[model samples]
Target: MIKKAPVGEIPFAIAGDSRIYVTAFVNGSDSLRFLVDTGASSIVLNTNSPKLKGLIHNGELADNLGTSGENSVEYSNDNSVKVGTIQYDKAGCAHIPYPPEYWDGVFGLNGLAAFNIEINYDDFKIYCYPKETLTVEDSYVSLPFTYKYDVPFVHLHIKLNGTLHNLLLEVDTGSDRIIDLNTPFVNKNNLLETKKPFAISRIASSDGGSGELKNVFFDEVIVGPYIMPKVAGAFSTLIFGMQSKENIDGMIGNNFLKRFNMLIDFNADKLYLQPNNFYYTPFYDFLVR
Candidate 1:
């Protein structure tokens, strides 16, 4: 028996530096808070979560594949993912050793790919509709995206030190920083040897892994037809994690994304952005002492 999941709206709360958390039901368990993360490949349950304890019954032991260093994890098809009344039967969940601090688990894009997901930052609500019912407002700008390793990747250009650099970046709604350039991309571009100075900051990944990166300022970042100036960016120096991948350049996080109302249509492989009240707000540079 298939339950109806035509349309629905999930309200989320912003906590701990623009992280979006929503309520979800997992494996017939009670409702628990889960972060709405487009960066995550699949539904990841925290082992430390009180409500999610012992949820990985049929999971198989495997290496935890994250941008960060590898650890052990359990991947199981014995679970189900649910948001409000919308249930995902085919969706599988993973149990990671490192748990999230603020939420019960992380809600990845695996199941969310079934709909046209819209996030209204101004209203703190996630509205989902059938892909066939997608309607784009005149105010929205559309950009095409491709799925790479279960996440959405988009092409954009950045101008730094009077040079134009075209790169492919991931739309990572889960991260709070503005931009994080991968290690290989930074090395290839000779960013560390630049005349401009940068600050060093220690960072942690979603799976409780730790790494370090250099924080720097960006002159201008061009996304689609939008030009954002004076943005904060990072040069990842981590030995492992998503930041070390050679195939991609970087990722755009919430600090850059909160400026717009966004929509992600997985079926059409399109991303839409519209300017909101938060667009003009000054960027918060955490690296600044």
Candidate 2:
């Protein structure tokens, strides 16, 4: 089902051992080996990284725990961060958790959000263009959702026997599978009607925290022009705070994204969903490998 969505690949490079790193730029200056994390709300760095010592302002001790479950008091402040050809001046920054073994820091939406992002998994390269200036020559559609830090999320509003329910979902690029729900939507829906619950396991985040997984078999889940039927997700009532809103329902992750071609315009705050043939052909062959 995911294969039917638009897909592409790029020849992206990853650095570091434990933490895969990528390159970045700030004000056109070279900055290297930044962690690429779609799950993080903002860019962050280790206090010991050469990049953070002098560039950060108003640095303060802050407590942070990510999907990895590593707890640490890292610095939270503002700074200019660069990765490859992209840079963000006065971007938000936080501390890298734990002893900081592998990565210098993470390159998150706080910086990437400034530009239109085009990730070509087929080519393994990421392109950053001015979001405010780009125009779509191609015809596309946009799904409705509330965005926090430029990430698109949907609220699962389900109905059963005249009763209605709702849950917020984050569309995640970093997640490997689909249907990560916090509050097992089916469990509630089942209570209204007699049906066997789909068996699911506990799903873990990149940070290593686990949540109750529930299979959501929806008549139709719509985003843009694409619709997913009987999609599976995790019930994540406990991890709602991981997203901008608590009581969040679930997250749409790679399992869904890999299905379609995607265009994200950060500066303009627009997202365009196009057919796979138009955007994914160049790198589609590679993705199959």
Best by TM-score: 1
> What's the lDDT of the predicted structure labeled candidate 1?
0.77
Output the number of the lDDT-best candidate.
Answer: 1
The parts of candidate 1 lying over 4 Å away from their true place are 1-6, 133-138, 195-198, 285-289
Error of 2 at 33 (Å): 5.4
lDDT of 1 at 282: 62
Sliding window of 10 residues with minimal summed lDDT for model 2: 1-10
The 0-to-1 C-alpha lDDT of every candidate, in the order given, reads 0.77, 0.51
| Candidate 2 segments whose C-alpha is farther than 4 A from its true place | 1-21, 24-35, 46-58, 62-73, 76-80, 88-91, 98-104, 148-151, 154-168, 184-209, 215-220, 237-240, 243-247, 275-289
Candidate 1 per-residue lDDT, tens place, 1-289, comes to 0023438777888765867888998887888988878888878887778887766466787656466666667878767778865778857787765554567888888767777888888888787778663556655788889877678998878887789888889988788777888899899889887735456767777656778878788778886678988677888887787788899898888878888888887778888888887888766634443
